[model samples]
Target: MKMTKTPIKVRYQETDQMGVVYHANYLVWFEIGRTAFIESLGFNYHDMEQEGIVSPVIDAHMYFKQPIRYGQDAFVKTWIEEYDGLRTTYGYKIEDGEGNAAVTGSTKHVIVKKESFRPVSLRRVFPDWHQAYSDAYKSEE
Candidate 1:
């Protein structure tokens, strides 16, 4: 499986009074990683948005391994976990300076029409995008 890594600098504002990174920040990092992953596959999310199609997260989950403080080197590794035209699941791993996993998460999303927010089969809506996802699809063996 191919994974895309995106480096994220921990910012002071992203921390709480304890100086630990806020939990929500991991989700943001996941977004960054997911975007990079899509681009790495030669897909443009903005173009999809322009075409009145959007993929919205239906579920999100995270497992925190440790707290990350400001000024630490961190990066998110992302890969396509599963895709079956109707829904796509992306897996994420956030690592700290020493290459230890700080957080692991997954987000599931489904393509929908921007106007009505109605679900649409990716294969029926954007065949090329669907095929690309299928070509890179991954799942536990």
Candidate 2:
């Protein structure tokens, strides 16, 4: 699939007394990776929100492999793991400066109406975006 790699520097404030990056910070990095992936596809989440469409995470899974210390540079590789009309799963890998994976995870989200929070199909709201995801997934095969 189409993947986007984003470089991030671990800030001291994101760590605990032991200097290891907090587990919760990985979720934040996942969000950053997801946003960058969408933007890479020429889509702006801000515009989607303004249009009354919101994508919220419905499920998440993370596997920690290595500990990342503060002040180290890392990279998050993100891609569309799967996408149906109503839901999309984004996969991520956080790698340390040496390219060792620190964590791997996936988040599943569904697009909904901001007012009612009713689930909506991305294909109905954004056909091009939906098609782009399909194309990327197929290309991987």
Output the number of the lDDT-best candidate: 2
The lDDT values for all models are 0.91, 0.92
lDDT of 2 at 28: 99
Off by over 4 Å in 1: 138-141
Candidate 2 local lDDT, 86-122, one digit each (tens): 8899999999999999999999999999999999888
Displacement of the residue 104 alpha carbon in candidate 2, Å: 0.3
Model 2 Cα shift for residue 44 (angstroms):
1.2
Clashing pairs in 1: none
Q: In model 2, how large is the Cα lDDT of residue 9?
A: 80
Misplaced by over 4 Å in model 2 are none
lDDT of 1 by residue, 38-61 (tens): 998898889989989999999999
Tell how far residue 13 is off in model 1, in angstroms.
Answer: 0.5
TM-score of each: 0.94, 0.97
- Least well predicted 10-residue stretch by lDDT in candidate 1: 132-141
Worst 10 residues of 2 by lDDT: 132-141
